[model samples]
Target: LPQTIVDTVVTTWRLEIRFLWIGSQCIIQDDNHDKVIEISCMPQIYGNACLTILASRSSSVTEGFLHERVISNDILCAKLAVKVFDQTAKIAHLIPQRKNVELEPLYRRAWALQERLLSSRKLSFGSLQTRWFCREMDDNTSLKDDSRDGWTFRERKGWEELERFELLGHWIKIDSQTADELSTQWYFLIDTYTSCEMTFEGDRLPAISAIAQRLAPRLGDYHAGLWGRNLLSQLMWTRVNKSKLAKDATPSWTWATAVGHCRYTDNDLTIPAATMLAMLAMTAATAFPTKISGAASAVTLGMSVTATAQAMETVTPCFILATLRCWFTLLKY
Candidate 1:
């Protein structure tokens, strides 16, 4: 009986999400077909086990719906923490892992990325406040309410008195301004029917294809390569762009599109082995000759890292070729 209810709710939520994200490229977790609403089901310690629920997986769906606002905020915070840690770890590999200094920019960047995921439509807070404020907090913020002037987080006098009144619904702001920003965004209150649309806007085809092509042979798993490529692209995008719109707004184009624009031929993975090899040979033809004219050991070490990265870029084709050859050899009985 519980499973049946969960399934019904889950299916509806999925449909709602699909309607919201009409034409964007998003990779959603394909599992969890149940729609039973729940709160904080994900294991925080495991880190990557963050489950984005459609409804909830709990027996009592109402409890899940009621607790969602606070839980949603917590989930966003946890996701951001994970990003900060992961990015810091990766950046440490590019340079020496040093302590005593904080990566402020990186943390900020991570927060922005988290915001994009949690509040992409700029309507997350409104959804929570409107839906749960009156029921959970007993603070009604409706169109008829005199406080319709603005939604302020600032604590003002007599604000506590307003808490006694039952919040009905939120004021609709068709256009977004600093004052009306909160009003415009959707707040998913106890009204289980409430949902918001999200747009998945970002271009990362080439990068994912490139990583997949490279890692396919060595890993003996084409899907793994593709998955890795997709995962890396997602991480990088999330790390760099804080908001989905920001990520979408970015004019970041992939090399595959820039090189040539045919269905299959232009794709770097599908290029001729000989032609690709020749390009690598030309690039690697001058590895060490481009040394700095006058640089001390410290400067040279920094330059060495940069030069190594550049050299790797040039020889990346060879790595791809080797991966292909390895895959072919495995396939040959």
Candidate 2:
């Protein structure tokens, strides 16, 4: 590198940002494919990871702001990630500390929830000592004593507890936050989940299919990423960085369509679900029934490519009208 060129780049443009760079994009671009089509390839578990000591900058990147590690690599973690219910807590206290606890780095990383849920057994390295959790353990972590709930693990009831957990637990991450705020749940889920590195951007939907499937029966229809119920409110996603866009990753209408990070950062600017519902109620109150356009009635699959409906928030007639008008309006422009 010449001194003159280096100085010019530094002065003209701000940062020569560098990090882990995989050449899949470069390989594809040399041939110039219009779209990076997602292929269907399912693995045994949700996904598999490779643990290797590659001589890479990411392997050595341990300083300042970018020091956080995702829980995907050493990704297997059992339940008891968050505060367990009181019933589980009381029983775990009665159980003895028969197993060893591994307290190293369990409480960090958002993806730990996925690893924790997927793995059959988990040895958590927490703040204090290492805690053990397995399919057969009565109690795992000393959560009662150490701010983590151990009751669910006690009584050797970990597996049945896990079945219920597998179906019910994942919702907690979304519920815990959205139940309180009620507006930005989908944005939170996307901001945390999509930021993760994947083998292909196409693998995004397949990786999270289980969660989507589980929620379908409960949340009605599922759109590409947003829920049908909360479609309009959730669709207000703005890219954090305009330069990086995932234009072909998804349809032009979805947040997933954009490449960079985005969010419904300003909910105040958006109309409330309650207001939308109220308008629907008012329209229905009139002599003429407000006809919900057929396209607006669904936010599911096989619809028009322009169809961008999905479910998320509370169910209501206004939801259809609100998001339908929004979709048509967006398509029009």
For model 2, the stretches where C-alpha displacement exceeds 4 angstroms are 1-113, 117-121, 124-184, 247-249, 270-333
lDDT measured at residue 122 in model 1 versus the true structure, 0 to 100: 28
lDDT of each: 0.22, 0.37
TM-score of each: 0.17, 0.39
User: Which digits, one per residue and each the tens of the lDDT, describe model 1 over residues 1-333?
Assistant: 344334444544764644222111122333222111111111121112222222222223233332343323222222232366457322111111111011212111211222222211221122123211222232333334433323333221134333211122122111222312221111111011011111221222221222222223332222211122222221111111222222322222222112121111111243223222211111232322221111112222221111112222322332222112211111111
Where does candidate 2 have its weakest 10-residue lDDT segment? 51-60
lDDT for position 69 in model 1: 35
> Which lDDT value does model 2 have at 60?
15
Candidate 2 per-residue lDDT, tens place, 1-333, comes to: 333233323422443333212222323543323222211111113233221111111211132112233433332334454556543322223332222111212212222334444444443333222345444343333434433344343343442343333223344333343322322334555665565444345444544444454444455455566566656555666777672655343545556665555665532233333223211111121322122111111133333332334343653333223212232223121
